[model samples]
Structure formats: structure tokens, C-alpha cells
Target chain A: MLRQLEDRYVHGLINKSVQGFLISNHGNDAWVEIARMANLPPQGFESMLTYPDSMTDKVLDGACTYVGCTRASLMEDIGMFLVTHPDLEAVRRLMRFGGPTFEDFVLSLDEVHDRACLAVPELTLPKISLNDTGVGQYVITTQWQVVGAISLVSGVLRAMADDYGALVVLDVGPHLHSDGRIMETLSVFIAEPEFAAGRSFSLAERLA
Target chain B: MTSTVSLGFDALDGLMPMHILIDKLGVIMHAGPTAVRLRPEHDLLGMRLFDVLTCVRPACDGGFEDFRQVIGQPLKLQFRAAPHTRLRGLLHPLDDGQLLLNLSLGYSVVEAVSDYALTSRDFSHCDPTVEMLFLIEAKSAALSESKKLNARLDEAREAAQTQAETDALTGLHNRRAMDQRLCDMTQSRRRTEFGLMHLDLDFFKQVNDTHGHAAGDHVLLKVASILREETRANDLVARVGGDEFVLIFPDCTDVTLLDTIAARIIARLEEPIPFGSKQCRISASIGTTISSLYSEPDPDRMLSDADTALYQSKNAGRARHTLFKDAFEADDMVAH
Candidate 1:
């Protein structure tokens, strides 16, 4: 389970047959790989674009892609994800000339990362994740998945300069399938931010 | 035999199996086959990757196509995120024993910068770099070819979208488009006395049975074209349904003015479409209604009233226009 200020990222549990998961991290991008063996469907595949970061009310419509899976095993399937590399100058062009492309989105991602790193060099990680399966909309590409206990970087870090406070909650089990698709099953989004204004973060603690 | 976090497979070297490190949420951060040593180069440590990217909306399970577009080289997958340190993994069979995964340690970097921007002569962080320059050049070429295919697809989608709003045979605006047009007409009273003419071609289906669908189509298109040409410039012609057309004239004065226009249309359409041995006789029964500024109501009611009048015209005799207000008493009798 993972939790932050207001945003929460969750993934289904790893199945029993699956031994463990894989983890990867780049610059700030986190890519976690869950390895398992559940006779996956031989023919399975799917993919989509998720606007996890929607601070700008920007949406990529046709840019949203869908792929079908043909052959797969229960544990794994062929999946793909779209990390649009937009052109920033193109966005400025839209703001200036009147039209934009995926380049604008690509550039926007870059801007957000740069801004995060500039504000708090500790948090902003930008890497595309892949699911390699036909299920979940998110293709958990380039994640940093650690199965057992993980030692956190020992540092008294300050609150990152984020317009929206983020948080996450997840449950991992043996009855789960992983192939990068955006998850929309059982989750929660507090609310849309009024522009980039900061919202107070609150959560209920569970006591054993 | 090899050891792993999940499914175990054969070792690259007899001693060590490879490991690929990924984040806690399962995105590949780095991928490569590594030698298995009791003590590895990197160590796995972390609760989960909490970067805002993974905490995105919808939780990207996997629907998007992803590949690192390096400045140069084909878009081949360069890395998988299993674990960055002490890359350790296994090749084990799934519980179903149908498949086996050769795994590795996928590690992470505190932060990564994958996007760059470049400008001419010099480059900015946002501009395409030399590597991206090559990638974009090639990407353009590939996209150009893709555009060709997409164009055909675009046309097909457009055709499908168009078909939903059109008559199958005559290529005229179907009832759906007519409904939209009526809504639009309701918005403005810019033109006084908007007149709706609901017409049903006499014995159109008989023609279809006698001459086949082809001849009926020819006849329908001919009538529709003539109706469009004969009507006032502001009037609209639409195939509201099968063998039924509604001509809407925003300003035609009175029933007499409309009658003259309908008469001219009847005269123009008197000619038969020669289908095989026999000449198919063509005629339309018309029902008209007016939405006057002095007494206004819902546009749908006007169409309903006009449709009733059209039925009366067909009932009395084909090839004529009838006004609903003129026969409202009879309409009341039928309503009861």
C-alpha cells in the first residue's frame, strides 16, 4: 500500500504462483515489475493514456490509444502504453498561433518534471510505465517495485512544492493481473483542484 | 536451476540468472541480464516508488504504447524496471505451470530526465537534441506513411458518422438531421412564417418491388433534386424518413404562396423515370403547417400537425398540398 497527501496509487495483489515482483527507477520515474506464472490468456492485449496529472485541464483525446491482446498466459500478456512526447514550442505555438499537438503534452510533462525538480529535487520522477498485459489501463512501465521490506532514503525532507498534495492506498494479493493499463476498478480521487491551489491534506489512521 | 523474486528460469551463466528492476507499482525502470553472485552489484531497498507520475489518474494498468525515443536508432525497448541494485531474480513456472519467467533485479534512480527540447544551432532543454533530431526525422517519415493509412481510416469513420445522419438510398438528410435542423430553426424567428411541408411519395414501395431498389433510388434522387431546386433559397429540403420528405420554408407568406410553389414542384416532377418497360408515375402528398409569430407552439407539434395534414392529402387524393389549420376540426375528430 502507498499513500501521499491527497493522491493514492494502488495496484492489485500479486498472485500466489507469482514468486516476487521487479522494481526499476530512473531519474525520478518509478517502474515496478511484478513477475508471476498464472496461465495467462495466450491472446490478450490492451493499452491507454491516463492523465494522472490533470492540473491544467488538458486532455489527449485521439491520443488515447487502445491495443488488443492476442496470446497471453494468466501471469502475463502482451501490453503496451503511450507516453506522448509532446512539443512544448508547439504548445506555445497553440497559445500563440492557435493549434497544438501531442508535442504540447510531451512538453508539459517535461515542464512539470522540471518544475518539481526545481522546487523539490527529491520528488519529481518522469518515466513511462508499461503493463505488458491486457488488463489495467496503466502499463506499469519503468516502476520501482520491491517485494519485501525496503529501506527508505534517510532524510528529513520538507514538503515538496506541489500544487496538489498527493496520496495513495493499495492492496496486493495473488488474485491480481499486471499489464500496464490505467486502474479504474476500486479507487478514490478526492476532488479536482481549483487551478493549482493547495488543499489541506487529511487521512484516517488505522490502528492494529 | 535459478532463484528469483517470482518465476525462475535457466541462468544466463550456469552460476547467475539475470534480474531487471522495476518500481513497486510495476513499471520497468531498467532491464538487463546479470550474473548471479551471492553478493550482487546493486541492492534492493524501498517501500514503493511514490513519484506523482505513478499516482496518475486511472492508474495506468496498460493501454498506451510506450518506447524510449532516443535521438538515434529504432524504437526498441531499451530498459525494464525490476531493480537497480544487486540485480537478483529467478526463472520459475507459474502456478498453472504453463509459463516460466526469467527474472532480475530492477533498480531505481532518485530522479531521471528523459525529455529534452532543442532549437536551431543551439538547443534548449525543451528543444529536440541531436539524438531527438534523428528520431523526429525518422518519426516524421513514419508518421507520414501512417497518415496515409489514417486518412483512409478517417474517411471510413466519416462515412460511418455521415451514414448515421443520412437516408440510405437517396443520400438525403435523414430524420435525425431533420430533427437537428428543426431545433436550429426554433432558435431564431429571423424569417417570418416558417412553413413545413411533409410529403410522402405515392406508391414508392410498389415501385421498389416492380423495378427493384435501383430504380426506386433513381426516382427518389430525381424528386429530391427537383424539390431542392424549385424551392426558395431559404427553404430546406430533407428526406425525413423512408419515402417521406419535409421541405421547410422559413418565409413563404400564406398557404396560397406555398400552393403555387408546390404546384410548380408538382409540374416539374410530372415526368416519369423510365424504369425498364414501364414509366414509373411519381407524385407526392403534402401536409403543411406554419409557425406564426402571433401564435407559437413547440416545433414538434407543428410537425405532428403537418404530418396529419399530409395523411389527409394522401387520403383525399395524391399529388396535392393540404393545410392542417384548414382541417383542424377533422384532426380533432381523429384525435378523439
Candidate 2:
């Protein structure tokens, strides 16, 4: 089933996908190829920009398949794009205004979405809650009636942590609730930068 | 050339989403259509922002400058609607020199309904996070209830086990518990040295015959208390039979110590026990045996040998203790 998303985010996703594909050495016509693979007409993605809402899953799936990357990776790329995008400066400013620290930014994600809805009334943002499991450990839960795009939220969070230069370990899984809404839980362990660096080296050695 | 879209002030006000407009002085200038619907009775237009609502997060000091500094930042504010509600939003600076307060429910919708006594129909169908929050809350409550039930069950089991091992009349360990203690002691290889003293009260039946059963029970309680006072904390004292008791002393094999203990118990038992309007004197004949003298220790054999010594003590004069091995050696010498 297709998940409906606000047109602004839909346009933003296409632009970022095309740019990301080109940066990764994919051809300039990657957008066209992805559109064709998703069983849409040529240049159909361009029409979604003016519409109030559009089906999001087909575009995301085609982009993932063409780039030979998982949905999570693509979403992460889009999240990073949102932070760095030139035309989305206002959105970037709003996000940076979350707080002075990276943890504060993470905590403000739900409020950020609430503000974003003022400009785009059609936006259906998930509710995000953070539980402090222990020192340097947190469990973030997102409950949404919408079927997809939850991974995009996760990507944004990781990018936010990166913006602060904080090293973290993340694990994501879906918990199905009786109310029929999918609750995505993300377990995060914020590691000391030095310890994270050491762990990366050890992991590399084991892989080798 | 850029064309500016204009609506009349009232038309613009009607089109606005959930918001409140506050002037530079932190006074509410206008309540948007959605905000008015949430709280219709209150006249919020002239009220101070701090008087009408409270800042919940990114805490402010309730000052005008503090409120201004929060512009363009995500915030949580609780509005004093007819029914109170918390809203999450950001402050936007409008061209007309007023701040627009855009609001939406910051928490789970189900919790909002539960806390505010609103119905499901009150909330839009877009978000089900409220339902999910309710599920989580229910699960936590169930887990706490299960833990309490398990604790209660454990307490009841412990109480039942205690009742099974205790003598109802004397509050001492009954014959069954004493047998179990003997088996445990004999089976333990670490406890090579042990002593058992078997005591039988002389003329105990005479007091029961003269007085009622209540007096008999009182006398037994008194004896049990005295035995508990005389024995060490590590020792076990049990009422093994009517007018008969046993004391098990673990990790002790000194004959002299055993004899001293037996003598003390005899002297204590010989004291006058006073019932209502009557006084009775009783003495105890005790038999002592130590485990170290046996080649292979057996609980049953130890008990039987103590009983034999007790029989000798009863036959000798009914007021002293007889050590089984000592009496056996004396008999051998006489036979020689």
C-alpha cells in the first residue's frame, strides 16, 4: 500500500535521491531510471511537487533498488541532505534551534514536527518518546498510524547525533501494538568518542 | 513584481490554524479559531500570557524577555483551556509585530483524553500514539501486579512450612522436626563431634492428675521456655514426647561440658513451678551421649543409647544424669 506524504517532503526526497545517486557515481538520468522502475511515467515525479500530498513508497522503493542500498541507508542519506540542503535553510535553522546540545536536539524532535505541521497542515508526524534506560543509554519509541517513512525519522536522529560529533550505537526494531499502530523502538548507546574509535578499529581487525 | 496575498483581518484570523497571537508586552492579542474552540468561555485576548498558560519545557522564567528569547524555538506550553491541555509549538515572528503561537498536542492523544476526560471522537484519526501509550501503561501495571502476587505466594508458603515444624502447645520444634534435625546432623561429614541429651521430667503426671489440663499446658510452656534459655543459640531443643525433651548440641564432644549442661538442666527443672493457688516441684533425669565414640554414627542408634542411659538414671534415684559409656565401663569393672 502507498503511504501518503506531504508534497514538500516528497519533492525534497526526489531532489536528494537524484543528488545522492549522482554523488555515488550513478548516471545523471538516475531519477528517470528510478521513476521507470517504480512503474511511473517519465517526469511523473516533477508533478508531485505542486500536489498537496503524494504516494511516497513507490519513489522510495525505486530509489533504494537503483542505488543498490537498503531503505535505511537511503533514508539516512536524505536526513543528512535535509541538514545540509541549501534551499531548506529555514528547516535547518529550526532544527538547530532545538537546543545548544545534541541530546537536546534529539529530545526536541517531536516538538519540531509539531511546528513543521503549521506550514504544512497535511503532514502526519509520528509521536516520539524517549526513555532513559541508563547512563549514556536511551530508548526512543515512535508510534505512527502512517505505514512507512518511520526509517526517515531514524535517519534524521542519527544525522543529528553526527552534527554534534557524538559517537553512538543504534539498534532499531518494530514493536506491533494491539491498537494496530507500528511502534518503532530505537535503542541508542552514546559511546565516548575515544572508545568508539577503538571499537571501530577492533571491528575492522575482526572483519579482516 | 511580487504580488502580496491579502485577506481582511477577520478572514485572516478565521483561516489561521491552532495559534494564539501575543504582543511584545506578553499580552494575548488574539485567539485563533482553533484555540477559541478549545476554550470558548475564557476571554483570552486581554490576558497576560503567563497568567493564561505556563511554559513546560526549555523552561522560562515567566519574563517577557525570556518568552521573547524562545521565539523560533520548539517549546511545550500548557494552556489553561476550560479543560487544561498541553500544546507543543514554536513562536513565529509575524510582520505586524506580534508572535504567533502555533500549537498541537505534544503528548499521546489517548493520555490527553484520559487526563482531560475527552472522548476518542475529540481527537483526529491521524495519530494513534495515544493508544500505544495506553498499551504500554497497561503492560507496566500488569507486571507490577504479577510481582505482588508472587511475593504474597512466597510469604504464604513460608508460613505454612513454619506451622508444619512447630509444636502448637509449647511453641517448640515438634518430634518430626527433631527427627529431621538428627538425620541432617548424622549425615553431615563436617560435624564429627555432637552430643544429645534426653530429659524426662520426674512425677510430671502427678501435677497433671492434681490440676487441670490448662495447668499441664502452662507447665509445658514454662519448661520449653527454660530449655530455650539454658541451651546455646546453635543448639536445637525439641519436645519429643509428653514429659520428654531432647537437646542436640552440634560441634561439641567434651564429656565434662555435656555433664555440666545436664546438671544445670536438672537443677533448673527441680525448681518450684507455681500455678494459680498451688505450687509444684519437679525434677528431671537426663541421659547424655556423644557421637565421636561411635565408629559409624547413626541417628537412630544415638537416640536409643541416650534412652538406655535415661533408663539407668531413672533406676539410680531419678534426680541425676547417666552417661552411657561411663555407666557401661563401671558395670564392666564390677563384673571383673
Candidate 3:
């Protein structure tokens, strides 16, 4: 879909109008958060979490909205992703490779709503309900008013925390009055995840 | 007792029972354990579960059918049951005979937290999401310090790169760096080459002499900014010296496109930039050079050649572009 959009808009003139086109490159922040969460620093983090420098400048970068909220995960969440994603191949790959990868986790907003039913088990939801969006070179989204299985998500995060040492949660925030449901919630978790940015920047504070 | 299959550990069954729900009475679901003689429990089987166990959110009259699944997919229903009850719901059409529709009340369990909700770094063998911001202040601090250190590293790397090549006042690449790039180009074995150009600000000295060094700095910075805006991402540009700049067209984007780029730049500069109360008009004279990747020409020689071409551009008229090797004879000496 992103490819489709790119193809349609190659002139890139009108679109080039917006600013901040690059990824946040949040790895250093990610490394610090990992160290802080794991109680390690510099070379100390290498044993348990990862070497501080393991998170590089380019790797730290993301095609994201806010740079701060992205990074690192707990072990259990990694396991859950390995179990839950629709693509068994990806799950196997992640299990073999070790990841709380954004592509493996972040979904189209409509997909989030559809997946919510898996978590909640009883919510009737629409398929392909939300539009997938583009950022940098990727597409991610979140939706509102879908019944969520928090416990399942929590379980995934737990497994990830055990397997790795961090947990990650992503949010596009909320959309009010979407099919009459105020769609807002913290939807992602990687077991016990370290914060991406050392100093957390509250989206609420900025918006308010 | 009805023949039942053993479903692993009893402890898991306690928290998350695997029982089928039957619509006998208003009972939504039944217990996992069986009764004596393989018979279903008489007293509990048909009883409404709400009467036996309390619903935390009785008002939570939300439909379970439309829940979100996994990270972002619409959910599918899974049969859920409690350990203590024994009821099942079977929905069937005559053709299919019978379909078991097991239903269980969904709920949240409260585990006695060992520690206060803290930061993720502060959590150990604990649920990652539950540890709120509070009580993890110490870990947060350590995390912040480490983050600061990493940021410092990035800043240092950027600073080093800038120091090696940047023209300080204008924040543009220096002449030395541009020449290095060209030298690499001349030495390369690739057949395709870049178009090189030299630009000199017409009447730049007048701005410095009249408006002060601060004004001069502003104009230079503005020019650099314009060049950045007008050029493609592949292009390389530098402020080689006072009022003189270099532009490298890495790959030839057709001459028409290059002319458009040049024209757009001039048009942008033609707009009077606010220089204090008085607006300053700026324009540039340009010289162009195109060579191949296999061309083993000297970089310094190329710049000199470009400089010679720029002089003709200035001599013929400022705010215009002239090509070297094409516009001027190679033997024509450029005035020092």
C-alpha cells in the first residue's frame, strides 16, 4: 500500500510540503532506557540486556511520529509476538531471531480492531475497518472502540520480558466518536519494557 | 461421570477454566471438573452464573463479539469456561445436528503486586505494563543519565563531521572537502560523471562593507539555505570561501532540469531578504563543468577551470550561468 502511494505521488512536489520527513533515530535513547530499566550502564548492560552501543544511531531511528515512545521490550512480549501474529513464518522467524520488531507488532488501525477481538474474545468487529498510514518508509495505524484482550497482550509482554528484557507499547492515541466509541487506550506492551526516551515526554502535556 | 480429557495442570484450569457453555437456564458456562458417575452437576449446571459469582462490572453490558484481536486484528471468539461450574450452550441447525457454543464470563484478575508500580527498568520478574511511573524514580534517573550520554555521543559525531568539512560562518561544506570529493570522482572508473559549478555572489563585499559582518553572515547563510532547498538530495554544495560557493551535480539530471534548479535559486534570491530595516538584493554568477567518472583530471584544475568560467559569467553578466570547456577555450587564461 505504501508502494502504491509512492507510485501515485512520485512528482513529490506537493507532498514535499510537510516537514520532519525522517525517522526519529531513537536508538541511543533506546539504549539508555534499556540500561536504566535493566540497572546497567556502558559496558555493564551487555551481560543482561545488551551492550549500550548495540543500539546504533541508524537502528535507533524509526519512521515514527514522536521519537520518544519507541524502543526496547521485555522478554515475554517477544514470545507472545512469536505466537500471535497471523504469519506463522514471521512468528517462527521472530522466535528464532529475537524481536519486539515494530513491523511484527504495529498493525493497521483496522487490524488492531480486528485483533482486539482475539484479546477480548467476544467483541464483534469489522475487518479492514481503518486506513493504513504512511510514515518515512512504513505504514502503521491504530483504531478505536474495539474490544481488547488486555490479558493476552499482557501475557505476550510477559513472555517477551522473559525472552528478552524489554517490552514495547505503541499508540496513535484516540479518536473520539469513531462509530460512537471513544477509541483511546494504551494498546502495546512488551512484558516489562523500558522507556524509549530516558526522559518521558507526555503526549497529553504537549497537546494540552 | 462423563468421560473427560485431562487438560494439563489444574492450576491453569483454576484461573482460566476450559468448560463449554450451555443454554440450560441462564447459566452462561460451566465448571471444568466433572460430577460423579460421569453425570453433570445437578444443582449447578442449570443455574445462572451471575447468581453464584458476582459480576465486577455488571453494567459492562458490552458485546464480546466485536473485540480487537492480537495487536490490531478483529477478534475471533474462543470458548472460555470456569473451573467450578458445569453448563454448556449448544447452538445447532437441523442440517448440522448440533454445534457447541461455549461461553465464559470474561474478567480481570488482581495479583497482589510485590512492589509499587515503578518504571520498566525498575521492574524485575514483574508485569511490564503495571509498573507505573511512580516508585521507579531511581531507575528513571539512571535511565535519563544513560540517555544523555548516548545523545552526547551522537552530538559529538555530528560535531566532528561538521568540523572536518563545514564552513563555520555559513554552515556549508568547505572548499577542501569539495575538492576531495571531486578528486575521488576523477579517480573513479565509472563512465558517468557529475556536473560541477562555481558560484560567486555578485556585490557581496558591498553588503559586508555597508551592512557589517553580521549582515554579511546572514546573506551567506541565506544563500546556503537556498541552495539546499533548490538542489536534489544527491547534489553536493559548499561555501568554499568568502562569497564563493561550489555545487556538484552528482548525476546528470537533464540540462533542462538543472536550468530549472538554477532559475529557481535565482528567483528565490531575487526576493529581497530582510537585512535589518533595509532589504538586500542578492544574485550569483555561475560556471558549469561536466566530466566523466574515468576522467583523471586534477580536482584543483577543475575548480580553476570553473572559476575561469564564472569570471566570464560575471563579465558577460551576473545572475547567469556559463559552461566551461564549452563556452570558453581551454587556452584562455582566467585572470587571477
Q: Which 10 successive residues of model 2 chain B have the least lDDT summed?
A: B118-127
What does candidate 3's lDDT look like per residue over A141-202, in tens digits?
22322222222233443444333434444443333345533333334433334523222211
Error of 2 at B283 (Å): 0.9
State the lDDT at A125 in candidate 3. Answer: 27
Per-residue C-alpha lDDT of model 2 across residues A38-144, encoded as one tens digit per residue: 66555443311322223456666777788788776676667666655555443344455454456666666666546434433334456677888988787888766
TM-score of the candidate numbered 1?
0.36
CAPRI level of candidate 3? incorrect
- lDDT for residue B113 in candidate 1, whole number 0-100: 15
After superposing candidate 2, which stretches have Cα over 4 Å from the reference? A1-208, B1-128, B189-192, B330-336
Q: Which stretches of candidate 1 lie over 4 Å from their true place?
A: A1-208, B1-161, B188-193, B232-234, B329-336
DockQ of 1: 0.01
lDDT (Cα) of model 2: 0.68
Looking at model 2, the pairs that clash are: B110-B130
List TM-scores of chain B, every candidate: 0.51, 0.61, 0.50
Report the lDDT tens digits of candidate 3 across residue range B53-166.
322222222233211011122212321233333222222211222112322322211111121121222222222222222213223433454576678779989989879887
Query: Highest lDDT: which candidate?
Result: 2
**Model 1 per-residue lDDT at B301:** 91
